[model samples]
Target: MPPRMSDAVTGPAWASPAGKPPLSSRMMRATWRGLPAKRYEVGWEPGLVVPAGDGSPLITDHYFPRAEGDFPTLLVRSPYGRGLPWSPQYGLLFAEQGFHVVLQSCRGTGGSGGVFDLWRNEAADGRATVAWLRRQPWFTGTLGTVGPSYLGYVQWALALDPPPELKAMVVQVGLHDPYALFHAEGALRLENVLAVGLGMTYQHQGMAPFLRATLRLQRRLREATTARPLRGAYAAALGGELPWLDDVMTHPDAEDPYWRGASTAKAAERLRVPTALITGWHDALADQTFEQYERLCRADCDTALLVGPWTHTSALQQGWPEVFAESLAWLRAHLHADTSGLRPTKVRVHTGGEDAWRDLPDWPPALTGTSWYPAPDGHLTRQASTDSAPLASFRYDPADPTPSLGGPLLSRTAGPRDNGTLEARDDVLTFTGPPLTEAVDVLGPVSARLTVSTDTGYADVFTRLCDVDEQGRSVNVCDGLGRIRATGHASSQVTVAMSATAHRFAAGHRIRWQISGGAHPRYARHPGTGDPRVDAITFTPVHITLHTDSTLILPSGPPLT
Candidate 1:
C-alpha cells in the first residue's frame, strides 16, 4: 500500500529525496563527538503489563520526555534485556526527540511470559502490543517502530498487518524469511546459528545462577560446533529452553512449514508506512535486507535505504548516532505529517574501497552483466577453455573441512579481513585475474556456476569472491554456497546465488575467486551419506571435480558516464 495522505492524520488529527550527502563531506568522525546530549529530561514507567491476544500480559518499559503532553510513540520490541534499551542512546534518545518510547521484552524473555521461540511467537505479540499502546493516554495515536537484528525482526512481524497508528519504521539487518536467508539452499549457517542462538540465551537472563547458566550455555555452544550429533548438544545446558534450539537443528531445510508462518513477506504489500531500511555491507543479512527493501519499494511504500561498512553489532553501536539522526528525521516527517526539509534519498550505499557514500537511483544499478570463465592456468579469464574435459579435483573430507574465511558474517570473525591464511590450504582452490589497469567499480548481484561431479550422492560447493591487493593479500568480498544432491547424472551443473555488495576495486588490484567443499562451522560440512550434522560415523571423503566451463558472473555494470 502506498502512502495515503488521508490515512496518517485522522485518528490523532492526521499525519504525514534528493540523494543524501556524501559520507566524507560530513565532518567525518566529528559528527559522532559533537552531537549534543538528549535535550529532554527522561522518565521511565516500568513493568507495564500489556495483554496479548491470548490474554497473557507482556512486560514493558515506557520512557517519555518529562515535560511532554501526549507525543508520538516510538515502539521497540526486543528480546535483548528490556532494561538495556532504556538508556540514553536508545529509548531516552528518541523520547528527547518529542516521542514517547516504549521498550518491551518479547514473550519468554525478560519479564514477559511464555517460552521464547525465535520467530514463532512474534506476530501475535506485536499486534497485541500495538493495540495496548492505542489505549495509553500519552500515545498520540501515531507510532513508529525501530531496532536492529532480532529487534528489527519484530518490526517486520508487526508491520505485516500494521495498525493504522503505525506511521513509520526503521529496521536494520533482519530478514523476512529466516529459513530462506539463514539456511540458504538447505546449507545451515552454523557459525551464525550458534553465536546468535547462544547469545539470545544469555542476553536477558538475570544475575548469579542465571549468569552461571549463560556461561554454561556458551561453553556448550563452543563444544557443539566440534561435537557429533549436533542436534541435542544444547539440551543439557538449556533444559526446558532447548526446544527452540532443537527446532533449529531439526529444520535445516528451507520452505519448511515452521518457517513459512513466521515470515513478514506475507505482509509485504500491506507495509504502507514510511520506512527506512538500513544495513551494512559486512552484515550477514545484507541479502535479506536489500530484498525486503526492494519488496517495499516495488509495493509503492514510502521507503529509503542506507548501507554502511559496519557489521551487525557495529550498525547499532558505532553507527547508532547516524542511525538515530536519520530515524528521528524520518519519523518526524511521517508520523507527525511534518515534512519540513525532508528530502529522502531513496538509496544510499557506502562504497568500501573508495570509503565514500553515494545515493543511487536504485540497487543492482543499470549494470550490464560480465562473465569470467575458468582457464587452464587457474586464471579467471574472459575466454572459456576448450581443453577437452580438463578439470580441477579436490578431496573433501568432512572430518577436516575447509574453514570459513572472513566475509559477510555474524560470528566470531566478520567484516573486511585478510584471507591469506585461508587461501593457502590445499583443500581450497583459487582462480585469479590480472591486475586492473584502472579502478573497477562493481556493485549489485554476484553469482557462480560450477559444473562438477561428486563421488557420493551429496556434497556442497562453497564459492567466494575476493579482491587481491597489490601486495598479494586476498580479502573476501561476497560468498555463495549450495547443497547438491546427485541425480545419477555423470556431472551436474549447480549455481549459487551470492550475496550483494557495492565495492570499488582500486587500480593494481586483482579479482580473485575461491572454491572449496564447505565453509565449516560457518556452514555445516556435508556428510557423504547425504544427511549432515546427524552423526559422526557417516563422515567420509568425497572426490570432487570441477569441469572447465564453470563461470563467475559479476555485475560489472554500465560505465558511470
Candidate 2:
C-alpha cells in the first residue's frame, strides 16, 4: 500500500501561491510519499528513552506514524527543546515525507533529566540514541541526522564514531572549532559569547541557574565602586575553575585543549558517511566550515559544501528552503533516486558588488593574478619600491583603545554590520590603491606581511581589507587580527591572518588596507603589558612600526572585463 497524499500536503500552507511548493515542507512531504506504500499501513507511536550514558537521562520525542511496516528514521538531537515549534516542524515534515522522525533533548536541558555539559555527552548520547532507534519496530534500519548549530554539532559528533545505522548528515553553521571561532587572536569575543549564551538561555530555559549566578555576581561588582573589591568579586565569579573561560584566558595561543574540544577538524577526517556541509560567508563559523570542507576533501570522503551570502540567522529564516531542497537532491542521488541536473566538482560563489553568482571548477580560479606591490605614493605598480624614510609609526594606548565601531562583534540584535565607522579613527592607518583597471574578484585567504616593532613586549596587530567607493566611503570587505607576544617578536617579519571575504573591487573602487592596534570590547584590549590578565587600569604608549617592504596579499582572480 503506497502512502496516500493528505489534504495538508496540497493546502496553501504547504505550497506557496506560486506554482512551486515551499521547499522545506514540500520536500519533507514528497519524501514521505516517495516511500513504499506498504509501510503506510503501520501507524507511528510516540515514546521517550534515556540512553545509557554518564551524564543525564536523554529524553526522546518519537513520531512514528502507526503503520504496518518498518520505516527509515530521521534523528535530530538538540540542546533546544524537542517540543519547540521549529523542532516539531522538522519532525512533522520528515514523518510526512516517509521517515520516522525522532527529536531528542540533550542532557540537562529541555525535558531531559541530567546536567548539561556542552560537548561532553554529545558523542555517547548520539550513539545510544541511534542504537535505540535501530531496535524500534517502526525503524527501517537506516538513520539520517540534520540540524543547525548545536544540533549540527551532534551530527558531527555521531559521525565521528561512524554509527552503523547512520547513513547521512546535514550540518549547518556548526561550531567546528570554538577556539578560532570564539576567542580569536587571543582575545575574548565578548559580544558573540553573550549573544549565543543569551539565545541559549531563552531556548533552553534550564540555564536559569547559571543566569541567576551570573546576575548575582554582576550586581555585587556594580555595588563595589572601589577597584580592589570589584576585582575580588569579579575574580570569584568568573575566574578559577570555570573550564570554558579559563581555557580562553590560559591558552591565549590558539591550539589548546579547550579549542580542541570545540573544533571537529580531526573528527571530520575520521567520518565515513555521506555529508552535506552548509555555511554562509557572513557566518562567524564560516572559517570552521571551510576548514572542515578542505579536511573532508583531503580524506576522500563523500561531501558537498554550500556557501551563500547570508548570516547565521538568515540561513534558517530564509536559506533553509534552498538548503533542504539541495539536501534532498543529494540524498536522492546517493539513495539511488535522481540527480540529473546537479553539478559536480564545481564551486559556486556570490560575486559581491555585482550581486550575482558565478560557477567555476576550483575555489579560486587559476586565471587570477596578483599585483606585485603598491608604491608608497598611492601607485598600483608591479615593481617593488622601498620607502626611503624609516617605517611608519603609531601610538597605541590601552586606556583609550580604538573601539570596534563595526565588524564581527556579536549582539542580541545583530552582529557588527559594517566597518565604515572604524575607518574614521586616527589610530588606524590607511593605505589606498589606485582604482582598478577592471573588476577584480577576491574569493580566498587574505594575508598581510609586516616588519613591525612595538615598544611593549605584548601587542596586537589588526588589519582590515576594505573597498573605498568613489564617494570615499570605505566599506570593510574582510579583516583579521593577530596577537604578538614580546617573546614571539624579534626583528623578523610576521604575518597576521584575517577573516576571508568574497568581494569584487570595481574598476573605479580603490582597495584600502586599514591597520590598527585594537577593536576593543569586541576583543579584549591588549593591556600592552606582559601579563595575560591585568588588574590595574594602566595606559601604555607603545611605539608601533610597519616597515616599507610590508605587503597586503589578496587572493584575487583575473579582472572580469
Candidate 3:
C-alpha cells in the first residue's frame, strides 16, 4: 500500500524535541560545546550494520541526523569506502536537509562480505539491501538512491529490478553500456581499467597499506625508471595479477568477452523507475548517458536528463547543491510526499563559453528543427554547392599519438575545464560554419554523416562539435568517436555520434566541427593495424576520403526569441 502523507502544515514527523534539543541542535552542541560558538556541527557515525542478504553482516556509515522520526531513506552504494571524504562530505549535507542517509560499500569492497566482480554482484546485493531497509525500525518505507560514477551505476542496476520500496533515483555520470565506455570505438580504456583496479584494491582493505605500497613503488620507479616497479606495485596493491590489463594492451579489437562483461546496455532495458539522469558535456561517459536517455525515452519511461559544463568528479563537489535540490524534489513528488511546490520535469543545462544555465520543459525541446551543412574543401557551408573538391586526409601515429589534454579524464580532482589546447593540434582537422544571424539554441545529440574511405582496412574517426566565437576562440560543446572496419570494396559511409548538450549559440557565434583520428590517452589510439591484441602497437598510414555528399547535422531547439 502507498504511504499516507500528513495534512498538517508541520506534522509531528517534522518536529524536534525541546530542552534535550533536536539532532541538528545536538550536532551544534557537539561541535561548539568545546570551541568557539561559531563552529558548525556535522555529526557522522561510522560502521553501522545494514544487514546483508545472508545472516552475516552488511555495514554502512550513517551521516548526520536531526531528531530521526522515520525520515525518508537516501541510499548510496559504492565500491569506494563510505568513509572517504568525498562520499560523506556531500552525504551529511543531504542529512541536514531532512533525511536518514545511508552509505554502504558494495559487496567485496570495504567492510562488505563477498568477492568483488564489479556489476556482477551489485544487483543482487542491492535488492537484498533495499529489502532489508524496508524492515528497518527507523525507515518510513520511502527510499531513493543517489551517487556518481560507480555509485551511480549501482543505482541504475538496482532500478533494473526496482524494489517496491525504491521511490526514485539520481544517476550522475555513470555508463549505460560498459563495453562502449570502457572500450570505446574498439580501443581498450587502459587508464580507466587500471584506475578501477587500483581503486578497488585500496578501498577493499583501506588507504594505509595501499598508500605504503604505492609510495615504495614510486620510490623504486624513481630509482629504476622501468615499468617493472609500477607493474609490481599494481599487482601487490590489487592483491592479484591483472591479466585483463595485458589483454587490453594486446587486443585492440572488440570481439572479446572481457569487453562484453564491461558493458551495461543489456541491463538498461530492465530499468522502470523514475530517474533523473545527469552528465557533463566533458565527461567520458556523456555518450553512454545520452544513449541511455534516448533508449529509455523510446521505451516511454519517466526519465529526465541534464547536461552541464562539468566533469565526472566535479558533479559531487561543485554541481551537487543544485542537482541534489532537484533530486530531492523529484523524490518527494514521486514518493507521494509534499515537495513544497516544485515542478516534476525541470532541466537546467550549463552552456559552455557563456557559463550560464538554461531551463527547459524537456530536452531536445518539443519542436526540433534540423539543419544540414555540406562539406566543400573541408569547409562546412549551409549553401549546397555541387563543387567537387579534393579529399581531406590526416595521418595517425601510435607511438606519439594525440595526447588527452582534458575533457572528462577522471582523476581525484573535480570540475570541468577546457580542452581547447589539445583541439588545436596538427593531427586535428577543423571545418567552420558561417556566423549565425540570430541566437540559436541547440539541445540534443549532434551527428555527422560522412562518406569516406581509408587506405588501410581499419581506422577510427573522432568528431567534436564546437562553438567558435567572433574572437576565434573555439570551445568544445560536445564530441564523439567511432571506429570503422574496411571490408574489401564496401563503401565507408558512417555516422559519427557526439555527446548531447544544451547551449545557445550567440548571434555572432559560428558552429564548427573538428575531425581527428584520436582524443589521445582519454581514448586509446586505434593503431590502424587491425590487430586483435592491444599490446601490439603498430603504426599504419590510412588515407581518408570525405565525399562531397557528407553533411553535419545539428539538432536545434525552438527559437528562443
Candidate 4:
C-alpha cells in the first residue's frame, strides 16, 4: 500500500469561507462536484508555441503555482479557442492548487497554423504535445489532462497511444464517434450540427457579424427555423463556406469510411488509465458517456461515472463548489498514486422525474424489459392489444413537418422543457397512457418497435417519451429518430432506439409516445421524393399510416404492481 497523502493535498486544511462544508469531502470524491472558487496566486505563461509531429507550431498557455517546486503538469487541448480555458476558476484555478496547467489550441484554431478539420489532426497533435511537455524542465515527470466536450474528445484521441508520461485523464461530455455528434440513424442532426459548424466558422474567420449570426440562431430560433432546405440556411448563416460543414452534408452515413480517421471507438479499445468521467442527464452526449464508461469498466480500468441534471455547458455547474474540490482530489490521487483522497469505482446518476441522485454498483440497474403497447385511440398498456384495436393514421406532409422540441439537443434549448406546444402540431400523433396510480421508475435504454406503412417508399420516424402531469403540463423525457430507407403499402417493422435516461413517472402522471414523420429542421424532412436532404429543396407530400404492432419498450427497474 502507498503512503496517504498529507493534509495539504487533501485541501480541507485550507479553511474555506463560512457557510460552506470542508473545502473537500469524501462524498464529493465519489460524486463529481466542480472545484471550489477559492483564491490562490498563480503565474501565467501565454503563447508558448510548441512543435507538433509534423513541425507545425501549436499555440499553448501554461500556468504555474507561485509556491510550486517542480509541480506536476496538466494539459488541455481544444479547438474552442484557448481564452476561455484560461479564464478565472477554470484553467488558472487548476494551477492555484499546485500544478502547471497547459491549455493548447489544436491545429487551425487560435494561433495554431493549419486548416481546421473537425475530428482529424487531434491524435498526432496531442501525441506531439505530450512528448514536448515531458522534455520541459519546468514540468515535473508526471502529466495529466483535463477539459470538456471537444477538449474531452482530444483526450480519448490521445489515449489511443498514450505516452509513458501521461498518468491520468478527466473527460466530460465526450463521444466515441463523430457520428454521435452530427449524424444519428442515417439522419443529419440539423440545428445542433449547424450551430457547431457555424461556431467553428466564427472562430476561424473571427468576424463579428458571423459570431452574431451564430448567436442569433439561439436568440431567434423560431425565426431561424424559417430557413428552408437546411443546406442553404447553414451556408447563409456563416456568410461563406465551412469545409467541416460541407463534409457532414455530403457524408450522411454514420458507418462511412470517411469517419474512420476520427472515431474514438478505435482509441477506446486501447484505453488503459485511471479515468474520471462526468456527464448530464439531458446532455446530448449522455448516452455515449455511459457507453464509454461501461466499456472502460469492462476492461478493468479505474473509472468513475457521474451523471447529473444539466445541459452540455452546465454539466459542471450542477454542484460547482463540491465538484471543484473533487476534481482536485481526482488529480492528486491519480498522478501521485496517493490514497489519501481516494474514490471508489461506481456509477452515480440523477433521476430526472424524481429529481434525486442514485449511487449504484453499475449502470442499467438490472432493468426488466417492459413493453408498452400503443393504443391508437390513446393509451399505453402492458396487456397486449386485441386485433380490434384501432389503428392510428395521420397524413405526414413534408411541406409541413413537426417542429423541434426539448430533448438531448446541443445548440438549442436543451434539458427538460415543456413540450405542450410541440404536441399540439397536427403532423404529430400522440398515444397517451392512463394516469398511473403508482409511481413507475423508468431507467436505462429505451427502444420503440413500430409497424407502419407509407404512401412513399421513403419516410422518417421520430419518437419522443414525455411525462404529462395531471395539470396537463407535458415535459420531454427522451427522444430519438430513425430514417426509413424505403417503405411499402404493406406494414413494415421499424425500430427507433431512444437515448437512455433515469426517470420516475410519479403517480397521476401520464406517459406519452409521440409519433411523427419528421422533427423538421432538427432532422431534415424526408423529401418523400426519394432524394437525400441535400437535394430536398422541393418535396412531395407522403401519407403515413401507423398500425398496432408498434410498442415502446422501456428498461425499468422493479415491476410495478
Taken over the whole model, the C-alpha lDDT of each candidate is 0.74, 0.62, 0.63, 0.72
The digit string of per-residue lDDT tens for model 2 on 1-561 reads 223344123322211222222344344444432232322211233336657466457876665433333456778888767644444356655554455678888887777877666676788888888777667655667788878877877888787777777777778777756566557766756445444544444466534554575564445432322232112323443322334443444565675655556555687886777777777666767777778777777787778777776667766655666666555555545542446635675456666677776665555455443543545544434565555233466778876777765554333223334556766666777778878777877877778876677766677788877788788887766677777665433444568766566678888888888888877655666777765532435656676766677778877875453
Model 4 quality (TM-score):
0.89
Clashes counted in candidate 2 amount to 21
Clashing residue pair totals per candidate (backbone < 3 A): 9, 21, 12, 7
TM-score of 2: 0.81
Off by over 4 Å in 1: 1-37, 206-222, 235-241, 338-344, 386-388, 487-489, 557-561
lDDT per residue for candidate 4 within 294-363, as digits (tens), equals 7887788877777787777576555555445556778878875555765553777778787887777787
Error of 2 at 137 (Å): 1.5
Badly placed stretches (over 4 Å) of model 4 are 1-40, 203-211, 216-229, 316-326, 338-345, 386-390, 558-561
Q: Model 3, 75-105: lDDT tens per residue?
A: 8888777654434334555565556678888
Model 1: how far residue 464 lies from native, Å: 0.5
CA error at residue 124 for candidate 4, angstroms: 0.8
Q: Is candidate 1 or candidate 3 better by lDDT?
A: 1
Error of 4 at 367 (Å): 1.4
In the order shown, what is each candidate's alpha-carbon RMSD?
Answer: 7.0, 6.8, 6.1, 5.9
Best by TM-score: 1
Highest-lDDT candidate = 1
